[model samples]
Target: MVPTLNAIRHSRRHLARWMRPQRRPVAWTFRPARAWIRYQPLGCIGIIAPWNYPLYLALAPLVDALAAGNRALIKPSEYTPRLAELLARVIGRAFAAEEVAVVTGGPDVAAAFASLPFDHLLFTGSTAIGRRVMAAAAANLTPVTLELGGKSPVIVGPDYGVRSAARSIAFGKFFNAGQTCVAPDYVLAPTHMVRPLAVALLREAQRAYPTVADNPDYTAMITERHHARLVAAIEAARAAGAEVLAHEDAGAAGLRKIGPTIVLAPPAGSLLMQEEIFGPVLPILPYDTIEAAIATVNAGDRPLALYCLTHDAALREAVLARTLSGGVTLNGTLLHVTQDGLPFGGVGPSGIGAYHGRAGFERFSHARGIFQPGRFNGLELVRPPYGFVARRIARLLIGR
Candidate 1:
């Protein structure tokens, strides 16, 4: 934990090391039609980061706001106070008090903080909290970039590498106890491969982090309330006629260590399928055909990320065009966020805005157009004289 923590601290400071010498420091040009635009700065931005991935999520947006030359007031989630404090200290060391400030508090503090008329607000958390954040920001008519999470799905096609797919899915779904916003919420495996995928996931999870009981790699639920809620959700789904599949050598039942749980053939409205399961539970739904699985995801709100396992390029492109996820990965998971160039964000209910790479810097700053007009030009056609001859030329220019 100490070594990992130290490395995270090191990485946060070095995140912008490669960004200094770029040809365009604050802007990116993908086409050649643009002239140099002045670097516009933004005012203070308020960032509300979530408990999961507190360090990365908080620092990513903070770095973006700073890169755009904006001051920031970050409110780290109260659930992880120790981590929150550590980050606050690190940020203080890196920046001045006026440039960046970290505030740690509860719900009331969050409400008060959000009410400030910040230039913009960047929030990463649950959909329920996102609504309140949006509403509070609306009080001042402030723009916001929300990074909310929903039930992101993973589809396993028959042509996929099942062993590799299982390993990736298991690491993502159960990593941080399945608390990731973009985690593979549930897997849609081919009907014939459903059982095999589940078996593979169980084996891979055990192999990746041996001894789920004493495994330091495994993350504990943030709070007792959250843990209880997860357990209740599992029980409710079980009572609703859902089949729960157990994994071996999981752990003793009393260690507050909920083992790797798999639910097979869960009803669409079942609690397990309805909401985001932020636990070590993986719901495996079987589909007879790949088309049926795609339809299932398309019917729901667009997810933060989608993981598809297939070897066919045509099929991959078809899925990419048909589905509206924020991001997609072919035969892999959680690697999209690692790409510094690709924009990171969500779509629709999953989220409203994206921020990463140049996108992140742009999100924090306003783009004001600067049109330097020539000394004497086409404007003479619309002079105050307003003669018929001049009117004819004005109409040509203005499309009157």
Candidate 2:
């Protein structure tokens, strides 16, 4: 909610600048003619938000749509119905129904919402669901912006301190119990530092939440099924010969909480390695050299975010050059997305387009090109009624 409010404030602060027309260059042949791009609203935008950070994901895009001068219809995830209802009530009181509205329901309703002939659609969720939303939107030939999730990786360069990297990783991974889409999904560290990094991560996690089961600061999985899935993945990694380190147990059943865990060198085929571990489970993989680490990251689908813990300029530049992700936070984690100036979205499978502040405004607005020609146009010399002058001008323009 705080982040969403911040986004709203950002939009308000920059709305005027974003709405102004941008000047474009005119060709030499079109002297005295001016060109510019007019930013116009897309009319209506459809937002399909996810369960995690429901309020922020749903309203942040709406902030952009509104700043772009477009009406919006939001469909909040079924998992967060109460908040959805609250949002509907608040928006209803604040704006006319035609201006802004919220719809709440299950997958069926979400599907129907996606099929609407909106001017543009933005969906934030898992890649599987993003695919379905895009297909539904295709029926209307509506443009879409997909903010999907993937296995975001962290690379701890040899030049950086393992302990420092571990602290940042632990904070990001356990912030929402690792429910965040941009959380560090796994770590690639020097082979010798793998165990040290894992130990440091556990120490940091313990310091943050001494008691995971009953601590108010520590969050639980959103659903029982999600908790079970995480547990199964941890067990699968352990069964596959990976060394597992876990914080104290949750102490009872049905708490829907799994203690923070670290899996060391999980096999390539293990569940922890195969899927995005959107939980408080950190996997540390060993890489002998930076080249090998880059190779490993490139082997997977392009991640949504990438973290490189290094102060060495060359090493950072090499990693930046070799890898592709939606965004990056150097020597830290999850801070890149908070920057209102930076565009946030993934490339390839991670996401389709970017949005935040001005980027968001531009995403929801159309760049209509406009031109004004002077009364004395130079192109008149090459008119259709060919004469000596016209032929000469045409030959000169066309290079003889």
Candidate 3:
């Protein structure tokens, strides 16, 4: 946590240096024949952060808000109070109370926070909760930026190395114990390759986290409710005829240990296929063609992220051209969010706004247009009623 906070502090200074001199673009040049206008500053902003990656998420928007010269109010997730208080202290050290304030509490607090007439609000969380936040913001007609998560998918092509592909995919799906919104919910591999890929994935999972029964690096589900939900989700998939291909009877007691399992051949309408399985339980489905995989995804909400493992450039290009996801990763997963210079949000049910790089700046800013009138006297034709001269001037000026 300390290390993460230190990184945030470093980034804040770096961004401040870059943004300090950018009040308006220096490229604006006055023409002798144009109209004049000026840019304006937005007042203040509000941000609601999620429990996962609390410090980083909170500080990310704070960095943009301060750099954009707008005061901000932050409502950190009540689920993690310690981190929220820690943020308040750190930010207080760096800014005035009013410049960045921290508010705490339950859904009611969140509602009140969202109802305030903020110039802009940025929220990060589940899509269901995001809808409520959006509805609250609508009360004030406040502009909002939502970073919601959905069922991200992975496609494993036969052309790639199965072992290597499975290795990378395992790390991504189980990272943070699959709490990540962008984690691959299910896998679409070739029908003939499913068993081979599944075997390789289990092998890689063991390689990545040997002794998951006692590993400290593994993150527990945030709450008992989530843990039960994950368990129930897996059960529902199993009852519906999906074979639980891995982790049999390992996760019991309060250990909160779910050793990277996979469900095989789940029916098309099973819960495992319909929702984001944000756990270590990976589901593998067989696909005859990549086109069929694309069609399946296109039928649903635009995913937050889509991943594919293939060696052929043509196949990769074809898939990218035909499908829409918040982000696409070729032959890998979850690396796109690490690109600090790239935008990191989604589209459609996955999300609506983007932030990171230039998108972050634009999300917190309102770009006002400026036009300057020239000194040339080309418009003094007929300043009055209706005449032939006025009509001609109108035709030339208005292009009527």
**TM-scores for all candidates?**
0.89, 0.98, 0.89
Q: Candidate 2: global Cα-lDDT?
A: 0.93
Please give the CA lDDT of all the candidate structures: 0.80, 0.93, 0.78
Candidate 2 C-alpha lDDT tens digits along 1-400: 7778889889889898888899999988898999999999999999999988988899899989999999999999999999999999999999999999999999999999999999999999999999999999999999999999899999999888977988899988999899999999999999989999999999999999888878888888999989999989988888888999999764723688888899999999888998998999999999998999999999999999999999899999999999999999999999999888889999999999999999999999999999999888978777778889898878888889
Candidate 1 per-residue C-alpha lDDT over 243-310 given as tens digits, one digit per residue, 9 for 90 to 100: 77755344534456666778887788877788877788889999887688889989888999999888
Query: Ranking under lDDT, best-scoring first?
Result: 2, 1, 3
lDDT of 2 at 34: 90
lDDT of 3: 0.78
Off by over 4 Å in 2: 250-253
- Pull out the clashing pairs in model 1: none
- Best by the TM-score measure: 2
